[model samples]
Target: MDFSSKLYSIESELTQEDLDSLKFLCLDLLPNKKLLSIKSNLDLFKELEKHSLLEEDKYDLLAELLYIIGQHSLLRILGTNKWAMQETLKKNRTVSLYRQMLFQLYEDLTSEDLKSILFLLNIPKKYEENKKFLDILYYLEKNEQLSEDKLDVLEKAVSMVSQELLRKINDYKKTRVKENTSTQSLYDDKMKLSIEVVEQVSSQDRGMKSTVELVQHVSEAANGKDLMDKNTESCMSDLSLNEQSETEVYAMNRKHRGYCLIINNSEFMKSDPRLGTEKDADFLTNVFTWLGLDVQIRNELSTQQICDCLIDFKQRDQTERDCFVCCILTHGKSQAVYGTDNAFVHINKITSYFSTKNCPTLAGKPKLFFIQACQGKTHQGAHAIESDAVSSVEERKTKITIPDDADILVGMSTVDGYYSFRDIRKGSWYIQALCENLTKMVPKGEDILSILTKVNKDVSEMEYSKDRKTSMKQMPQPAYTLRLKLVFPIPLAPFKPLFQETN
Candidate 1:
């Protein structure tokens, strides 16, 4: 029999309920299939035959059969099952079979009824097709064309598509020639060109290394003669050593001392810019707050406002704080960030405020800056590295200096010339990972530097294949000249507050 004839024959032998059950079972098997497993197809066929044995048990049996099959495998054969189940769901709107299917395909249902139809169709699969389908379906459902029941069914049917299939679909769509109106196509092309241009100008791959070398060269040159002369002049100008003495005392009292200021610059000056900055800001704020630091979460700020915030933060309680942290989450160029007024401000200008000589409060403290901004635009295909136990010597060497001295740690979201992942909903990947690691590490008694090293590993190693294209990464570099170890204070939870005995 032909494929259609065979499908029809199976349907003829079973009641409508039994046919529905088999369809549901087939959908469920799609996503749960292992990479190399052949059992999915076999198990699904077996369950369909099993459900066919009972007449009255047919309606509920369809869902049970689909549920028996895995989500991964069911999604692979979604093309056939999706259409059939959708038709069934459309006809029998009130069936619980449809409801079960919708719940299963929540990720892929587009149009509420379609989502409901997909969900009701519930092909068991580990992966779903495009999220856009579901998003679109949801939009339609909100318009009242698709009932809640039908939306549920469609959701399940669409969800049964496999990750591999989803990837293939997305890749094909990206490569397709635009057939829309020339005007619309032209506008899209222009937008893409602009993004590419911005990316090229901000490429970090070569620029970041160059920046490091440049800074090293300048530091060496300055140290050779300029620093000594400046030190002598500064000593002559300022005789009071009280600040230095106070820093030493604070360092002795706290094993680790430092301050971290996390700023989220996710929003832009333009009211309706393509990217939103607030999400990034909120992610950072939550992280620093969890780390028990005095975190200042700001929205779109002017360049001057940023500088002033930094200046004020440093001035307050400078003597006791041993370290300083500043994180900027904004749309950026290679070495610049955008102010709320849409002006480009060089990063160096903002960081220069906390230099050893300029900011006395943070003079001897370890100042660390974490940035989540795209440095450049370049598209490099993902490459997998072997998971081998390499020696720790390969790790980047951290700069060491006196505690009553200067140190800087700067981390960028991407290597130059690459796009940093910004989720319109989830914020930047680096900030989320950084904050997540810090929150988890601090409680385990790990130091801040150690936490950052893990952050680097997490960002670099995450994979984003064409199928799951949302993945992105970042790079962090720590430069220091601290003579003492700096640690931030961890406040005791309110639940553990001390109770004084009445005298």
Candidate 2:
């Protein structure tokens, strides 16, 4: 079969991820502009064919690239196996030292390291948007900002991120110098052969053969460098998350932290208006916005609207987000919170919208729901200690049901069969305390559970007074199926500037 037909057969077997790897490997072989347009393996093979590196008779470069990328199984299409290629590479491998070094650096640098490196780089905002290391390197090459010989900017950037990475750069530099020396020696040997060919006039055929061998050697060396570049690019693309450090902390590195959807049902059609729900919504928006979330408040949603809003949020492409937050401020009953239309939306139904089967994007990420409503009509009375703190408490109580899934946290205004307090002027006792603790404790590097514990403590101490005596008390509750600790560290830049909303 012809080379193009063979490539077509190979392409059919490879996934999009495999194609991406193949394209990455070609970074050194082709220009950035060309690569950006070459979407498929056919397009890539055409470019290689034009360069005469992937013809039917000459495909060792392709074989070597496949071997480097651990796709030696694919080498069967090129009529080669890993064993034969391994033996060939042992004597003379073509992939370059510089390319291999960069691949190692790309593999070694953690996601945090990539961010740090990107911060240190002086590239344009457009290029910096792509977090992929290969793309960044391509941008550097395209802009003529970095190259094999130009190691200053890269070394400086690596030094700031990691000493080990910097060491790799230095090692590459040392090895590069040695390669230069060896190339100069090869040049000297070629010159010596030229003189020998000149002196051997009687043996014209032998002199011609010697010159041909020298030319072939030079061509092979060039091909070797090209192949190495491709191999390095492709290998870098294959980096997996499993290679990263095994940590208990969930990854929270994203452009936007996640969405904070607040359903603030203040005015109800059938029931009494939630007096201080506006304050709760405002506080939640500010707190979540300060924590780097995109806060959106939906006022007075009905049962259907609430369900649709949650469904919309769950169906959204949350690939770039690290967490999902939904805050509900309304009236409540036994096992559910009441919509503005006095319809009961069960807490389980609300949480089910973001379950793994429903919302795969948020499968392993933290999903936090904070409810500010009463669970029952039963008021939590203070038995041992009572203090004078008069706040109008909500008579409607709501039960919080946690879904049987991992990485979910439900913060209830009060425990089952109990009334939760809400001041006419301020907000719900649970929400105000929750927001206060989030603002105070998040900056102190406290986890969400720890902050919630503090909220419980703060709310449990307060008492509402009817006439002169303290009459009502409330205790906030937290139900969690979290696998990892969720901590929102205040950004280095001040929190005040991160969020600006009118209360």
Candidate 3:
């Protein structure tokens, strides 16, 4: 039963005392002897928490209030929530004004029998998130205060929303696919034209003619530059190796490809040499190259060299690129990797280089770090951690600390304080699994993080037992401070751009 109907059915059994109690409750909720605020209804429930009434009594009172409010022409049903009968107050709008507008909208909506509700619920579905709309559905499902039938209606409504959302998404994808096909055709024509221009000029080079000059003079180009040897390809780079879904081929703002920095530290003098590191680099080079990255492979780097290499990359212009990725194949300790000089460079230092404040060109772009190194010594332990001892009390005040707002992801070969599993023949388990899954999942339209999760699951589940009692287990860990969903070989329409909203 609806809240109103249920209250009407039970009102016959209630005495004057019960009705009086509800009237007193409602009166107490009024601000300064009047319904002075829009939060009066919300405050009524909040204040009811202090009462010791039975659950049924509380329900009865709530239903009675709802019924009375509806009957008294108080249809301005709205709260701070998005799907509330009223509109949510904006940050700049006062509650009273917001409430008035919400009621006006509600009045307009009710005249058409819930037309607004259906329209609001049908939020546009994309690969990116729609937080407000999705949250409203979540709120409806989790609200236990509503009756069963009402909840059922909400569930069905949400189901229809999902169905409609899916159809719209599929249609959108079809349209994009069509658009992308046209783009591809245009790119191919440009490439063919450039090739013809280049080959034609080269054929007549015996005369006083330079093909470079001829191509530049004849072919129309952007920025007065010749479009020769045009690579008619799309790159997924760090986010994807082959997934076309993640590719943003036509983005004039984003780069055609990102840069991949490979640091292979194998010549460890103070420690055991990390063999098979080259295999990892070679394989990744091919993978990332196929994925459309400008692959840079460096060998035998010291701590300072590693730092300097990153600094150099950071200094270079990357505004034309979508992201930056670094892969280090080396031995390591907890939170640090060993350079060829056997010096330790903390991982955070490397990541800090790409922060929005430091790397302005890559401000809003993704920065991926794939480290194949040991964290520290570890063993399986599951127990309650003892609390820290109390210290001398001092004056304290609340302080709002904001987190770093940059898109950076670090993928580790093993959990902290654990050994990474590897083979002298096949290279490290994590890197191998990452490469394999990237190849497999990219075509299937899986995003970078999902692909990484699969890599982690597969690596952790692998059995490398020397005997029945002895085995090796390696769990990869990916830590990220990403502000947006990242896909490779393609880009999705961002609901809103982060880090690029200029002053």
Best by lDDT: 2
Location of the lowest summed lDDT over 10 successive residues in candidate 3: 383-392
Instruction: Assess each prediction's global lDDT (C-alpha) against the native.
Output: 0.47, 0.72, 0.55
C-alpha TM-scores of all predictions: 0.40, 0.47, 0.44
Error of 2 at 367 (Å): 0.0
Q: Write the number of the candidate with greater lDDT, choosing between 2 and 3.
A: 2
Query: Per-residue lDDT for 24 in model 1?
Result: 34
Off by over 4 Å in 1: 1-260, 269-277, 314-317, 378-405, 465-484, 489-491, 494-503
Full-model lDDT, candidate 1: 0.47
Per-residue CA lDDT of candidate 1, range 1-503, in tens?
A: 35344434344334433333334333333332331132343344445455463233233334334322222113112222322333333323222332333334442323553444445544234333543343333334455545533333333343364453334333322322221233354455555655654455466465555666655544554344444444434432232111121122114244334455655554454522425345556656655655455566666677777777877875675666556678887655555655666555566666677777667766656677777765553233233211101112222222222233356556666654455665454445677678677655454334566677777767776555544756434454444444554444443431121222122
**Model 3's lDDT to the true fold?**
0.55
* Superposed Cα deviation of residue 132, candidate 3 (Å): 43
TM-score of 3: 0.44
Clash number for each model: 101, 9, 13
